[model samples]
Target: MTGPALRPVSGVPQRWITVLGSGPLPGRPELVADADLVLGGRRNLDAAGVPADRALVLGPLAPALDAVAALAPASAPAPAPAPAPAPSDGASATTARVLVLASGDPGFFGIVRALAERFGPDALDVRPGTSSVAEAFARIGLPWDDAVVVSAHGRDPRTAFNACRSQRKTAVLTAPGAGPAEIGAALLAVPGIERRLVVATDLGTATERVEELTPAQAAARDWPGVQVVLCLAVADGAGGADGAVGPMRALAGPTEGPDGWALSEEAFEHRDSMVTKAEVRALALARLGPRLGTLVWDVGAGSGSVAIECARLGAAVVAVERTEDGVRRIRANARAHGVDVGVVHGSAPGALDGLPAPDAVFIGGGGADLPAVVTACAERALRTVVVTLAALDRVPDVRAALLAAGFTAEGVQLQAARLAPLPGGVSRLAAINPVFVLWGTRTAPGSIPVDSSATTAPSGDS
Candidate 1:
């Protein structure tokens, strides 16, 4: 009547499967046994504090059935093996007893779910222990409820990375490959990621420790058996851990203004070959609308003026140029303007590859391949494409390039008048040659038109 095994009313013979209770004491339903089957504590049942007459002890998980077999009397026939655990499908019988061995707590992301699925949810019995994640958080003395928890095992690391990058606090469950080092490497590559703090190599019986490390340093470190990693940062990480806020600088608009752009020519210190004339740049930037949060690319960035202007307007910008001399000028210009403009010492389209896709692109030099770059940007659906062409013949190529790239292309011819000395007594408007401003917004229909409108026409910078 107090047998450990249970045999339903209908089955082949009266054979049954035995389930064992874990770790400590009895009266905890000790073990379930059949006529000749033993579990939990068999020969040494009494030593383990269970009555041998009724208790059957199966050994560890690997040889559980073998332990029961050796303890049974040779003359007794073995009971039918518990129906090869029900199929994984939920349709399996709802009532069954199964054994599961777990370190710490099986309920904490361990074998509990597997047991529940095989035996049916209602039949699951649990033996709990401290969860790994819990131990990890405790080891670091950090509260976990407010933390975003993610598993990096076999899952794309981006989900966990984004959680840590965007949230103020996050706990990452690491796998062998996606551990502290991998996560650290990615965070290091992100701009401004240095302001965040990291906790790596937590949990496990040995080598358990916690400390602060910059993402760059952490990613470069070699770590072993680290179960969890944590990332925490203030929402505005512009000020580093020491809390020093840096100077403010803009490249495109008045150094200070809201929705600030439409910058004046005097705002830039150009002596002035590298400067894109203010009036011409105005129209180019309108079509481009290079603003913060988005990314813009400027190729043939003479002084890096346009790219810096874009960066100042709030968008991340990168300038590409081939001349080492031009490269130096661009960097100097970008620094003078106090805006962070990435400079690439290479040519267009090709140099743009491998970089993050951009929101807009400006081709200030690729006159021959201007159409090709525009076509590629349009195919990728960049938000905008602006090209400044000075040669009379280059205008047709620029217009055709924009049109071929899925833009409702529009253009303008600008000429500016400069004050010239008239016999040293008066000043006269000296006519500057015309420059072509051809651009298009590679946008969906109903979007704002690419503004190629200009105030004055001049050759130097119309």
Candidate 2:
């Protein structure tokens, strides 16, 4: 048998790559002087007063990354471990020294992560600047400890929009096409959410501009530089008929989750025991893992019990209920629990169309189109999908649907009974109806070769 090929050894020493922050760069003359290559954005390099000959403009990240990689040491066969080197081993012992320039804190959703991933954490030295979110918050004199920061730069803006819709305070890093106008328009489109938008552009720079505007005003303007938006939730009476408002709490979201989940049947306003039993809900919530920055869907939300509970746990929730009475009960339960659950007055399969994708889904009712509804939810949910069924006949069909949709399927039957008072002051078990909780976790798509000849290409979700 042929011997295994040996791994390559990188002979380069731990040379420094300082990532300088943007705008009037902090004094680090020695580091800059030692740098053989200085890479940064055009504005950042100019502001730092780096020589044109030494500076490389960072345009497309791919090309820039390639340039950076070329500076690494050449590969050779692996060598045996050696003792620590002497102090005489200086800058000559390592590869070329590179210094990178970035805006704000490079460590926070910036180039530091990319550099670390490319050249390992030991190869870098980072000098961070005040994050843009902090500067924006400071400009408006608002406390940011409780503020949630999300980025729409080079990624999906829907999650950021969802964060703004649910959270009391949020800061969004804007991208070229996904800037204030796009984000504001999206928020304006969603009903039942009232928020004020604050836009700060070129913060801490010579051309700094900050403006507070309604969603309509923000959607009408054009923003041309680096910008951030602070989405602040409007108080109950800010624009209500009465000018009175509730006291602002220290924390925007709950400091901790509720004392208990899967609360008593009486806790929610349901019609004719339409809500999922407390025992089953507890198990479902455990599987859902609803929390910050996630969206959960409660399909066939009879009383919206699951949706309301999820909202209480700090998740942005959408409750889909077809009946007029179910919708009213859901709204009432949400209000009673001091939580916000977006109630959709429509049936599934048809209703699930325009809704934002969910992190998890709880199907309490599927109506006539159970198969289609389950399939739709499975396709959209990012993490887990939990389905509740009272009929034993539906078990195999539900399990098969989950398995076919690339989820690892499993289930359990839960039957609970409470101690009831007997006529003679004795107690007896009060048997509750059993429920089957069928759940599935999306399988991690393995590395498989793609065939160009195939009609359909593989998707990220697939």
Candidate 3:
């Protein structure tokens, strides 16, 4: 036999949809008992003692939402000939009540959003419980105000992984496929990444479990019914007190990105002044457009000044520098600025292989092979490419390479004069060397073949 379809009872003038948050049923037991129609997962329905005639097992969201939408006040059938008198509050003797059971705080990444969107806020009576992220952090006895919480349920998990990689503390709400094991396996792929995972499962239940494990350990296990995973950076004296919990935080989430960018030359460590000048770096950064959830490549990263700045702006950055000392400088500079930059010790065009595709690329130094390097980067770059060169002769070749790789190219010559100190407290305009800043925006997505054999000048710092 088919189940009863959702329909408004005659004479009802109002409806209430109460979302039961995580944990045992709260003080509002009558909300479920009196509900004309109930909706929830199997466990929630059973736990709430909903009658089979009144229960609607929640599965695929669309049908359930449609069922609820049919019962809105506007759609209610006309009152019976002898309709019950309306209460002083305007509701009739019979008011339709919908109890929506959800895990944790339904208002937080849960069913409340969809319900509210369909029925409007006035139709809902949301009762929130502690979120799984909050419970996970509480299990470890750590303050969560500073933690970045991201949901990977029914959405791209990469954003969650990147947040964990970039921030010191991250809480990821997990789904079946993107659970702790998957998160652990992805983190294991990042070089020099040091993080400990706290997997919390069956929160607020009799079989509740919360365990801490390294990425390798977490990756090796099959995590069934995992609710949330807390990714914490591994560092000396990180956890608070006797190294189990951290101090409370007045603020929440990761500290904001740096107040400013294009820092002065003194901000980074470079050999023989082999860094992109502050003025040039500023415009290059604007063209690159770095932000959270994006990956940027800084090729020929002499001192990694651009890479460090991009990292500070919240983009995942990789710096490719051929010289051994240059790579060291990049790593050191990244640490000095309290940012994470993946330093690759190799040349471009060839070293570009195997690395993940980038949203944007900045080619700061590519000697005689500048054109070929630009071609290689443009081929894989998803959005834009910006190149800086001191030699005006290479502008045409660089522009051609960009065009060949399906980019709309543009160029400008930037020459800035800074105020210099003269004798007797006087000032003079000290003209800096002119630089050709060429940028290309992809006309469309997809790769184009370009000749990699073209060579310009031998590789050198700009």
Candidate 4:
């Protein structure tokens, strides 16, 4: 009367999951067809012909990962009696089989990291495809080993934009709201930026499209479904006179920052000794904290030494100089250093109005409008403001302005004596004019303490 004797079942069988790259399954269609559970984008699930009951479309990542974690087998099953090939089609009806589809080389800024973090690396059998960055660079026949690559997907695009501005070549992985138009607009805002934009859409598919355009041209259009963007600096004749590719590079990414900073005044073209002294500049550069993807304003930029140095350190610089000769000097110095510095031919406080909000500001020569310039710079600078002054009288006013603007102000008087050759084959310390270097760091939210002790000299005082 009893039904056919039931075979004894052991523990829940172990599941085997294959994480496949974008496009077709690459001769593994049976994996999708026979999978007890399938996870991918809507397009991937449809293309793979996965049944509705078995398919789980990826949307909010948490829920998808939760589902995957929930379905994991509780324990390992007994081993087969003899050696056998791992299941290619699917696991047995009692065991769960998972197939995950992802775009591009998922390991490269893709879903693989999430999978590995959630399920452990040993749980995944990954099959990767070409990344969008590689595909975009390939379309232009350029080697990307020297290019900076950044992802703007589901994150801030500023870093990518800054990389594009600072580096000669950069690849940006695009997402909604941070695609070609946005990137184009950001680059267009930088006056005298020389860059070409390549927009690639729907990579690795039949409808893939790629186009090269100027930043202005790219900004003017509404790019839909952009997958990748390449920002390239206009060739600077690194190629031969016949326009051949330049010699291969030994390194990758953007060129390294200057070998030395706070360069000697002799390295720059300055009027008389009006340039910020190298000793003072050394402290000023440290307080300014200039780096890639930041904008720094050098107010009253005489000789553009600080501006050029900032550019050398990978910041986008705007040098504001009142005198025509000063502006010319800034440009010449920036050129000599082989870096880009936007020179504004106007006085500060007034000139600072039109420039983009700076991450840091260095007020080297504000003169009579020193207080006003400090106020203006303090209001707009995102992180810190540094002011160098020869007259001690202006220190109090600068500190007041910075305190009013919610900054933690600190100051130092630097006086260094350089080695001067003596008549007897000896050296003497020749005193340099003392200068006051004042820096103000923007206070974090809900924490604004105006330290009155900032005016006091630190430990060693003359």
TM values, all candidates: 0.46, 0.76, 0.82, 0.83
Give per-residue CA lDDT, model 3, range 268-317, as digits (tens): 99999889999999999999999876778999999999988988887777
| Superior candidate under lDDT, 1 versus 2 | 2
Residues 331-401, model 2: lDDT tens digits: 88987987767778888878887777788999985445677788888988878999998888888888888
lDDT of 1: 0.55
By how many angstroms RMSD does model 4 differ from the true structure? Answer: 10.9
State the weakest 10-residue window (summed lDDT) of model 1: 453-462
Candidate 1's residue-wise lDDT over 1-462, tens digit each?
576776432222222232222333232332332123333323235443444564444333325444433543334234346643533432123222333223334454333443345433334434454555566557656555555566654344545554443334556766545567767765554443333444545344345577777677777878875656766654343543221222443432122323555465566554445567777787888888764335677877887678777766756666778788877877776657655566778776676666545668887854677777767666543577787878877677777777776777888888988788988699999876567877787546322222231111110000
Judging by TM-score against the true structure, name the best candidate.
Answer: 4
Superior by lDDT: candidate 1 or candidate 3: 3
Clashing pairs in 3: 240-245, 240-246, 367-457, 368-456, 368-457, 368-458
Which regions of candidate 3 are displaced past 4 Å? 1-15, 27-29, 49-54, 57-60, 75-96, 236-250, 444-462
Pairs of colliding residues, candidate 2: none
Q: For model 1, state the Cα shift of residue 424 in Å.
A: 8.2
Give candidate 4 misplaced runs (Cα > 4 Å).
1-17, 23-27, 75-96, 236-245, 445-462
Decreasing TM-score order of the candidates: 4, 3, 2, 1
Higher-TM-score candidate of 3 and 4: 4
Local distance difference test, each candidate: 0.55, 0.73, 0.76, 0.76
The best candidate by lDDT is 3
Q: Supply every candidate's count of residue pairs whose N, Cα or C atoms clash at under 3 angstroms.
A: 25, 0, 6, 0
Candidate 2 lDDT score at position 68: 76
Q: Give the local distance difference test score of model 4.
A: 0.76
